[model samples]
Target: MESISITPTIINPKRVFKKTTGEEWYNYYAGFSDDFVSEILNSFELPKDSVILDPWNGGGTTTLNCALAGYNVIGIDLNPVMNIVAKSKFCNTDDVLMALDIVKYLRVNNYPNKLNDESDFLLNWFDYNTASYIRYISFSLQNKCNTILNSKVFSLIFLALFKLVRKYIGKFIPSNPTWVKKAKNSNDKISIESTKIKIDLKNILREKLSATFVDNVSSIGKERFYCASSTKLPLKEHSVDAVITSPPYCTRIDYGIATSPELAVLLGNHPAEIDNIRRTLTGRTTIDKSFLEIESLGLTAKKMLLEIFNHQSHASVSYYYKNFAQYFIDINESLKQIKKVLKRNGYFACVVQDSHYKEIYCDLALIFTEMAEENGLSLIHRQDFMSKFVMANINSKVKKYRDKITANETVLIFQAN
Candidate 1:
């Protein structure tokens, strides 16, 4: 049969609701449609119990859909919180009731404790009483690990608090655009009110519990999620039948910092661990400027990096150069690991978006194809779909490096050579 090129018509974003209970729990910043994943997986003529792999499972869309389709799936992500979130979606009805019971217990017995020493991120983003309540909740959840709900159930509560804090605080001040915590001006400090802080945490917690405990939800198959880097996949050779995932963008959107508030709630005591995880993510903004060594880059990626390095005239030119070089290098390393795990003739599909640095367009799909070919994978098909407005500052009037950047989502499929 002749090779076919899948088009945008094959994808329908509204199909995310097809698995309402599974998809509803976790909505990370970078996520794709569940239908998109289903279409790609269905294209291949694989057995029902094939083992599928998702290296960069941002919001667990690939893993969730695969489980619902009755395939065994392994999802790996560097984000600790997301690892639990992905695994939690596969929880049974008994697990949901257990999570609800835990939430109820915490609500009635736990009292807001005075937070004497909290992280600055928490202090700035949450008001005093809000921070205290979060501390209280975290304290209470930690104490009841043996009986009520396992660590995973505790994560559900932590994630709920994480969502509620951001929801209410966002009403006060918009999230900082950059990764670093910039010095807030005087007027920004005055906007947070104590009454706003007192927004019923119990009510929000119960609502989250209700949403998680759907009427009739069942796990399709055995699914596992691991907190591991994509560059170093810990799987046996030729083990997985198919690999499907969406790698992070090279546009310097700090995945760690974007989810830092959640991390703050989860790992408030472990500041060093938080920083280490941030530094280890694929396209983190804080690159080591002194370390200028570029990894194994394909011809297309090298050309793009050099062009961006030469053309970039922004204030943070050095940082941009490092970020571009590091992203491709990391991706190339990850592709090699992916090839090691995929069986002969196994399919590899990636959902990526094109990005812009200054005026230069980073054709991520083309660059990724080059990397895949270098690592002995043959391109089978490419599909382009109109993505939502997730680009950086596309609508803003500011003339930043990432402003006015736009592109469609491209799915590049490859088969093992």
Candidate 2:
């Protein structure tokens, strides 16, 4: 099949409602379309034994689609919450339903009063009693899982809990759609009794089970995912036939904070675990304040760095530059890792949107193109779709600086040389 231009909607996750099972389990903000991944499988000439990989497997879109099409696949993400979400894709509906019986043994009043600092993080969004109930259910599920099979069965249950937490906190969804914040007033926090929590979660599970095809139909083994950072992949050299994924956007979205509810559920009571993850994630707003000498950045990236550094806006040099620089460094290392694992002539397909450092255009595709080439991946195909102005919307003040440059949702295919 000859390659065709990708539709702009391929980058949008609006098709999530149109999905089932694991694809419908957790809808991440940065994930691409299921339809798009299906299209890629239909077009790409992947062999039956080909190992497809998504290093930044946000919401498992690429990996799930690849697995569904009967290919050996792996998905990796640093977020533990996503690890559960993605792994839950392999769960059987019968096993998931049977696992719900474990929850009956948990008594709301029996929860430990001695909460960890991280467990307390849930209190801001939920009341103490409700939070305790949540922790009780979470811990009960953890304790009951004795083997790998039970652990994965409980994962499907946790996916329901993850979704239920969001439904419980609908009032907390702030204007910035990316963030789910703690309500300012204590009265605004969610406080459902123990009975409702269990009932609501079970209802969600039952509804989803009836609708979703949870059983793994593929001949290949399940659990084809890992919880790890993108900069350091656990795979061997030249093991992968194709790499398809969208790394975190260069736009400083705090994915850690964006996914606090699910993170709280996965991390059990260790709330501060997110801090380690946030600092580790690419394009984090939190600057680690580390100085890195430029190595892998191409001329285009270096030039953009200089432009952002020279800008007179607040913290352009001290903060924004460092943030962008760190992103470049991390992405460059990830490209190197991608190159190392990809078989010779294996294709690395990426979907990245353009952004800005204040009024300065950060052409992510072009910047990534330079770094990919520097990392020994040669760009073979490029297509750009007109996109809504993201940075301008992110910072309304950018309008004063003649931010006439619009953003592009670009798809670039690079072959490992």
Candidate 3:
């Protein structure tokens, strides 16, 4: 038998992952593809029973891929919707057709005239008719009981159409640049047909759910997942065999604020509740200046924090950096716990990118490498990967700000000595 060597390619920072059919399955938040995860696993020579943990398992990519690879996997995230998404994506189902039937039924009969008045945030983002239709679909699925299979299928459907109601709407003013802004509207009479939208949403949901259903069923084994904060995972010291994750970029991307509007709508949370959610999120833009001062410990981290602090006339840079610094501190603490749980000689593969704060660049991979070394992990290999997906759009003023920083991303690999 011939031995096949596996080499992990360093991606170009300026290159974007080519879009495939499954691309839309993630709604632009697909953190990594299955091939990427598989390559990482192969490089590590991961054991079949190795316990894998992804601290920031956005959209369940790592969890699902790890499970299918026949490893015991645990995923942790602060976002409730992500928890739902992970669960739905990994839970096994016997019949996707039944799930499609449920969606079809809901689409036909659950068209409510109005949502509860308490849902002001939902009303603000979605037109009245669209909001009503979504409310009906959501209400129909609430508390419906079934096997893990049915539940996950329903979740996929709900999650797929979660943003359909407001897909073409205009951007919301005073939004965070890190998050995708809603489109702004110039006219009041935008021709949005409620029935057509619902039908299209239903069809898309069914097709996606069916594909995921077939793929998961065809797989021979399963993986486990956890819906919790990585900062405080449930694992014991030195228990895991490997850790692979890409922590959120510093203050550059606010996960909660970006996804809050959709979360608020799906969860039927009030505006007040949404505000509270935003506050609890790690990368939120609501942090006070005092928090920013506290985060200015790391030289680069502090420098960027101060720059944002000085330029307070435009955006709330302080709040972003403060939250970002908090996230880094949390990651450091979590890595310490991970060390305790990882077995001797275990490996940690981190996929991270450098981010811009004001005009300064923060090399997060390098910072984490130092932090991990301080905590008994040794730096073994560092590979640079190109991520064509630049955070700031080309023509935006922010582009000039980012131009001051490097335009590439890197991935670092570390091992426990």
Candidate 4:
């Protein structure tokens, strides 16, 4: 139970979480780094059966790494798409291979030749031919639902199709599922040959199947994931040994839009449902202003929000202020839930980035530490380092104000008492 040393160096997942093939379950954006998780876990003295809980288990980074390290884990997230990811990553090698086999067969043998989808979301992003191809795969998968049910094959199929469509077809253009702005091919400026380069679905599937094979999949720990909100985790009090997670960024990166293509395939047949789902996620704005008690936000956070609100000359300032306020409130509620489930003296570590709200710095790590302490956990350690990803994200927002952005993160560890 010695504290781990921290260097000023930033933690990068690409460098830290290296494994054999088949580790890339989902091409998710902004997941916790496996190396960061492993570094923290190694510093803790724990039993082999210690239960690790990651309530915001995006892409299953924490669960997958810890399971490989032989700890049992319970990961929870409100997004069903991410739930599918964590669950699929932990599936046994046989089941994963089985899923790949079934999906491959269905995709190739029973391909539907026509598009039946009238969803504007799908239509706007995909050309007619691409749409038809995607629809055929969806139809074939739906027809084989019984065979794919309770297995990871459905998720694998969805993920492979997601990559094929997003990388090859969608061209990484839409900011969110809402696609409020009309969609245009960014590649139009390039050349017809580059944009129209043929993509072989069968070849892509074959490559995906090969990449999805896990050799030491049997060593993965006993794990479970829930598509439940973190504010109301479905676990008993004092049940978990440790909590390792990184909550969604305060930056306005829409999770709904980030995974819209996957959702379109998995949940949405209509384009309107995409916006409906976006509104339910924690980070989005709230139109109702009646419930905001800005005064209740801690002094540190309240100062940051007021600065953003006061500095803004636009009518939309209130909207941004309210969204920022709601984000902190939501985080506080989640902290209470984490405290409730963690055993006394158990550790809770979060990787959080400090972000800007209209050019005013929001010391998110300090705010989260204060909030966690208010909810019955005490801060044990704090480490800071610069992250290029954070700087790039902030710069995207800062370019509007013509301000320079510097980004750094803090690793806050707290003990439940």
The lDDT-based order of candidates, best leading, equals 2, 1, 4, 3
Per TM-score, what order, best first?
Answer: 2, 1, 4, 3
Clashing pairs in 1: none
Single out the weakest 10-residue window by summed lDDT for candidate 1: 1-10
User: What is the C-alpha lDDT profile of model 2 across 367-407, one tens digit per residue?
Assistant: 99999998899887777877664535655676787646577
Tens-digit lDDT string for candidate 4 (1-417)? 333333323254332444556445556656667778888887676788899999988788888889889899998887776777666665554654565566545443344564545553555566655555566666567666753324466766665666666664344454433332324663332122212222344444456554553454555567777777888999999999899888987876677877776666565555566676677677765444458776655778888877867874574366777788888888888999999999888889888888776657778888897788888898877878777645244235467764556666677888888
Tens digit per residue, CA lDDT, model 3, 1-417:
112233445343231454443434545353656667767777777668788888777777677767777788887776766766676665333435565677666644435554777444455556666566666666667647543223566666666665464364434523333354433542442345667766777676656643452353345335555546666777787778888777766534566666755575566535666666556554555564443233323455455556666765555443454566666666677677777777788877777777665566667777777678877787777877656555554437766555542444566766776
Q: Can you list the residue pairs that collide in candidate 4?
A: 177-257
TM-score of each: 0.83, 0.90, 0.79, 0.83
Error of 2 at 70 (Å): 0.5
Error of 2 at 146 (Å): 7.3
Q: Please say which candidate is ahead in lDDT: 1 or 2.
A: 2
| Total colliding residue pairs, candidate 1 | 0
For model 4, what is the C-alpha lDDT against the true structure?
0.68
User: Which is the leading candidate under lDDT?
Assistant: 2
lDDT of 1 by residue, 152-224 (tens): 5666666666666666555443444334352264334323333433345445445554455323445475677
Clashing pairs in 2: 118-271
